[model samples]
Target: MRKTALYPGTFDPITNGHFDIIERALRLFDEVIIAVAISQDKKPMFSLDERIEMTKEAVKSLSNVTVVGFDNLTVELAKAHNASIIIRGLRAVSDFEYELQLGYLNNSLDDTIETVYLMPKLQNAFVSSSIVRNLLKFNGKTDHILPKEVQKIIGNMTSCTLH
Candidate 1:
């Protein structure tokens, strides 16, 4: 049986940190699915379709990685994809607290699904979707946090054309 893992997130724009996590996850799982969550609670900068396309483009070179949009809970999505594990990225201690809580909740909701956390590469630890959004809002350079294509998308959304 193939070991599959689902990486769930809003991924308003795919960032370098996200790519790092996906790359690492691909190493552990036979297949990694980048699940973009469509949540009503949060208004994302990029639409679900946009996020899906961007994520696909970001991971286009990875044969074992696939991107898809999901409206269901992470556990449900994991079950649907036949994934035994859910992959999450941790950038700092603060992120761990919330992620740990979510992991516990998911495990409680479905004992068959497990959450695995991967720390971002040391240099990309500070890169986050929110940080990239803010940088684009102020026309700040976000090349360090996001891939070139993602930076371009955020720039377009914020009406800041990159040269």
Candidate 2:
């Protein structure tokens, strides 16, 4: 049976770090689904459509990878996608406790589904959606942290000059 993994995140703008995890996940699973969450807890800087478009553009070159959107329990979404594994990216020690709690909760909710954590390449490890969004908010450079396509889109979106 083909093993599918679900990598769920808000991916408000899809940073290069996210690309690192997705690429690495591909080597371990038959298919990796980039599940963009339509999160209710946090207000995203970019719309769901924007997040999906950015992710699609970033991952278009990858094979055995698909992108989709969801707004329900992650385990339920995984079941809907026929995925048995959940991919989580760990960037720092600070992320561990929270992620561990999530893992425990997810497992409790559905023991059939397993969660795996992968770390991004060191250079990209510090890059995150919130950081990228904050950089854009301050008109800071994001060329080094975001995918080229995403950088272009975010550049266009934030390039408003007050006359």
Compare the candidates by lDDT and give the number of the best one: 2
Q: How does each model score on lDDT?
A: 0.87, 0.92
Write model 1 residue lDDT over 23-58, tens digit each, in one string: 999889999999998865788877789889889878
Q: Please give, for residues 1-163, the per-residue lDDT of candidate 2 as tens digits.
A: 9999999999988999999999999999999999999986788887898899999988989999999999899999999999999999999999999999999999999999999999999999899999988887787898999999887776676545411
- Estimated TM-score for each candidate: 0.92, 0.95
How far residue 155's Cα lies from its native spot in candidate 1, in Å, is 4.7
Clashing pairs in 1: none
Residue pairs clashing, model 2: none
Total colliding residue pairs, candidate 2: 0
Q: How much lDDT does candidate 1 score?
A: 0.87
* Root-mean-square deviation of Cα positions for candidate 1 versus the true structure, in angstroms: 2.6
